[model samples]
Target chain A: MSLSDQELKHLARLARIHVEENELNALKDQLGRVFKLIDALQAVDTKGIEPLSHSLSLSQPLREDKVTEIDSRESYQAIAPQVEKGLYIVPKVIE
Target chain B: MDISSLSVKKIKQLIDSKALSAFELAGLYLQRIEKLNPELNAFITVDADKTLAQAKQLDQAIWQGESRPLMGVPLAHKDIFCAKGWLTTCGSKMLANFVAPYDAHVVEAFNRSGTITLGKTNMDEFAMGSSNETSYFGAVKNPWNLGKVPGGSSGGSAAAVAARLAPLATATDTGGSIRQPAALCGVSGLKPTYGNVSRYGMIAYASSLDQGGLMAVSAEDIAYGMNSLVGHDERDSTSVKRAEEDFTSQLNNPLKGLRIGLPEEFFKEGVDTDVAQAVEQAIQELEKLGAVRVPLKLPNTSLSVPVYYVLAPAEASSNLSRFDGVRYGHRTKDYRNLIELYEKTRAEGFGAEVKRRILTGTYVLSRGYYDAYYLQAQRVRRLILQDYLNAFEHCDVILGPSTPSVAFGFNEKTSDPVSMYLSDIFTISVNLAGLPGLSIPVGFGREHLPVGLQLIGPHFAEAKLLNVAHQYQLVSDWHQQLPAGIAQV
Candidate 1:
């Protein structure tokens, strides 16, 4: 499948990347090549096969519901690029 | 003593015998980092003071006769792991200044084992590129040849261990990130069965495929690290709670009755002739040691690259959404609205390769195209997994060249991303199948570059994988061959 220039731009926007006009053509070409390579999957008949999500078929172990507090919050917030009043600060969304 | 060249086992012995203090070893590694890291670009942050303090505390514990399994062994972690107080950038500009508040589960496990933290090693931005070129900090030069690329996302860790900068370094694999570079750099790297190591603190690449592993001088060291890293963790939903087995116990065992499957697809067209020669020689050595080469077919092997591209990016696009400018990473200096801020911040934070992946991922996962792309990729992934199960029925382990070729010259495949992606053709299927796979230095390729032979085992079969790799290392001197300057150091 070919990606239109508009579709590529929309993807870049959604991905939060700035793709220059020149680079878009290169990306388009690369994406096309990659998609073409992946298209080989279409030939395989997977009608009866179960699509595996995790590698193992093990069930999640059940445990009693419990809550414990580990006070590493102060230490954890210490590395944030920006923090304010014990909260990770971001530009106002509602305002 | 130059402790950098010592194996993890030897380091443990020294620490236990009181011949070397953990503090001394940590100091020596810190000194090496100071001296060699400038040229290698192997580290993003070197927490010298913190490391020294931890080593001192471990030394005190050793004095009290408190013995831990990996006590006093100095090791470095890939920057992708979140270590409290250390910058955990995953080699991306978006998280460049992001300091992790808590340690990843792997980091906690190492800390519990009293392993000294040397520092955080460099990697490709968000673990995207095969070469370290995609790192936002800068490209990591191969310790073997400065002009060549160190196989990457875990390139810095592999190069660091190769340069004797550290005895052990933590790494991760999604699509050949751990094993490919390990092979190219002539070291040992293992990606345990998925869920073997908890992904709690590892920054997500493709959540389904990403797994924590290690890069060391030998498979034995990988086994030791695996023993410590693997086990069920409640915090990580995907972690498997399997019975813990000693991964290194079978290192001395002969491979006489071992069935080693050699897939024809891996040796088919697209594999470099030089790499094939090295792998063939390694296989010959294994055969001499009693391994019977059985022909196996992973019929869907050719489709691995395409399937992985779709799935890895689809997951990456979603995982990376957390990196929007407003939350915990680089933010745009000026923006009129929230949307613009998000765009500007992400654009500035992520590098070219990362941006390309995110865009591609978003496109694939978008509305109206999910079935055509994302869902189809998942189905293909199952077919790939089935191919491995079918092979395992006939053979105990599968063997192949880790990459199509050894370490290429810097910027060799950068212009052609498709060619670069093909480098992972041999390694991606292991992840697809959720099986344990490892890369060990088998021999040298063109220009004396390292060639890695990949060993793939069935699910939760890390012990066997380690045993086979360790047995190979015993009879071969390839793992002992260090890069020129690394040996001198």
Candidate 2:
């Protein structure tokens, strides 16, 4: 399965990445090889086979709803590359 | 006393005997870290003051007659685990600055046991690559041969233990991050059954397959760490609620009458003859211990690489989406809009391999192709898991080479990600099956690089796996072999 430059760009956008013009051709080629490898799964007969999302057959264990808060804002914010007013600050999201 | 060289069992013994204070042990390891970590590049962060403070508190508690299993044992955690007041980067610039507000369940467990936190070890960025080359931090050099790559995503932890920077360290494996590196570095590592250890505080790579594990110089030390870390946690919905078994208790158990499965696919071509020879010798040693080798089949083995690439990356793409630069982590300073900010930040923050995976994952998980790729991969995943179940029906355990070859030189497979991914070919199937797998040093390969033999057991069969590895270690001197420079330091 060959990947078009447009599809590659779409995937890059969905993944929040920017592909350079020079790298696009290489990525397209690499993605094609990977997709070709993935094509082997097409031959497997999965009729009536349940998709295995997790290894365990067990159901999710529910916990009782409770309100709790632990304060580590000072500790957590200490590691941020940038922080302001006890909040993690990013480049201004609003123009 | 070079505390870093001591096994976890010996460290505990000294603590219990009151011969060495926890503070003193922590100080020894800190000094060792000061001495060797620069050369090895095994640790991302080393909080000597904080670790010593924790050690002093444990010492005071011991003076008051308070007892704990891992009290004062100096151990480091992989950067993937969130430790309060410590940066948990998961070796990715995406979360490079994210200090966890709360401890991961494994971190909390170690804290509760009063274990001294030496620091955070390095790893591949977001656990994506086989070699530590993909780390946001510079790649960790294998202590044995400085030019070679340390087996990775858990490369730092493995190298730390190998270099004697820390006695034991925590790691996580989605595929072979723990075992493969541990093998290459000639240390022992165990990837417990999925959900065997809580993943609450671990930075997610692949939710279903990622498991917290340990890498140490010996199987006994891995067992000791596992004993404290493995248990059900309410915070982790997937944590299993099984009776806590003492992993070290079976260390001395006889392997007589045990049936070990040797899968034919594992011994096929593409396996390094040196690695196959070492594993074969290890198997022979186990045979001398009265264990019988039985041929087993996992006919769908080749599918693991393709299946894991689809599923793990799919989960990773979703898991990594949380690092949008808005909450925490790297953000672009010059962007006209939020969308552009997200794009540039992610592009800048993530390494090449990580970006590749996210793109592959998003492509497969996209709207129109979901069934053709994601759903089909999931079905193939089940078939792979079933192969393990069927093998277990006839054998007690499975043995194989943890990696196809020993540690390759730096930049060896960097350009070829496909071949690098195949390095974990033997190890990924166990993750897919959710089975417990352990890698034990068997012998050295070319250039005296270490080779490891993998032992896989049924789900929640850590005790048995440890037993098999420990029994093998008794007769073989492989685990006793240390990298040359470590002893001098």
Candidate 3:
């Protein structure tokens, strides 16, 4: 199963990665080999088996509705690339 | 004195008897790291002043008559875990400058038990590669052979423990990361049941399959480390809430009448001849100690590598989406729009293997292929788990070679992705089944590198798995053998 250049670009866009033009052939080749391994799963007859999402059956534990965390905006924002007035500064998506 | 060969238990005894001060012990390990780490590339970060300060505080507490279980013991935290006031790089350029404001649950628990932090060990970038070659910091070399690659993404942790840079180190396994590296570097490693250890603040790889575990010189040392490492954390909902267990409590359990399952598929053609022979010899030793071997078949075991690639990548694609350069980690300095910011930051941040997984993950979970790839892999995952459920009914524990072959030289399998993925074939099924698995040095394989024997148990049976491994270590000297030239360090 070989991935076309158009399909490879679509995957990179969906994954939010910038794939260089030179890197495209190598990436396509690597993915082709990986897909060959993954394609083996298609042959297995899993007609009635339940898809196991997690290995153990665990329910999300509930906590009381009270606020549990102390405010640490300053500590958290200190590591952000761009922050102003305790708010993260991202590129203007609205504009 | 040459305390590098001492186990965690012996270190604690020396500290308790006042023969060694906590501050002095910290200095001894720091000097070793200074001398050997330059060549081994084992440690990514080592903070001498902070480590000595913590050691000094522990000495004061001990002087004031306070007691701690693992007092003054030095440990290395894998770079994937978030250690407060330390750079938690996760071996990726994205997190290269990220200083964690909080400690991971494992780090917190270890710190509370009075284990002084030696540093964060290097790892495969985002714990993705089978060999340590993917690390941005540089590949960690196997202590046994300088030209060979240490199995990864916990390669640095395994190498550190093997070189005796630190007596014990913490590592995580998403698909045999801990076990493979431990096997190649000649140490004991335990990957607990999926929910047995808390994942809070542990950098996500594949959430369902990723689990935090330990690495040390001996199985008995691992038991001592486990006493301080396991606990339920409300922070991680998947952290199993259970009664406290003293993992060291059962080390003396005899192997008399023990049922060890030897799966027919594990000993078949793919495994190297030497690895299989060493594991077979180790199992024979167990039989001599009164263990009965039961032959069994996990027919679906062959499909584990394919199933893991699909499921793990799917989960990782979703988990790693958080690294978009907005709140924390590396951000692009040159970007015009929001979308370009995400793409370019990640493009520069992640290495080839991580990007490969992210892209593969995106493809499988995408609109048209989701049902064919993701769902099918999950369904097959159940069949794999069911195989283990049936096998355990006939045997108390399953034994096999931890890896197909001993550690390979660098670039040997890195050029081909599938070949690298197949090296983890023997160990991935346990993660899929959420069972506890252990890798202990049984003997040497080809090239005179270490071969590890894996013991798999039912869910939350870490105590049993460690007990089984301890029984072997009691009769074997493989775990005690150090890298030839490093013994004098």
Expressed as tens digits, the lDDT of each residue in A1-95 for candidate 1 is 77999988888776767667887788898788776776777777778676667677777777777766577767756655568888977667896
lDDT by residue (tens digit), candidate 1, B165-259: 88899999999999998988899999989988999989999999999999999999988887788888988888887787788887887888999
CAPRI classification of candidate 3: high
lDDT of each: 0.87, 0.88, 0.94
Runs of candidate 2 with Cα error greater than 4 angstroms are: A71-95
For candidate 3, lDDT tens digit of each residue in B377-420? 99999999999999999999999999999999999998899999
Better candidate by TM-score, 1 or 3? 3
Model 3 alpha-carbon miss at residue B110, Å: 0.5
Assess candidate 3 and give its lDDT: 0.94
Docking class of 1: medium
lDDT, candidate 2, at B417: 79
* Prediction 3 TM-score vs. true: 0.99
Clashing pairs in 3: none
The model with the greatest DockQ is: 3
**Leading candidate by TM-score:** 3
Off by over 4 Å in 3: none
Candidate 2 backbone collisions, by pair: B104-B201
Q: Candidate 2 lDDT (Cα, whole model)? A: 0.88
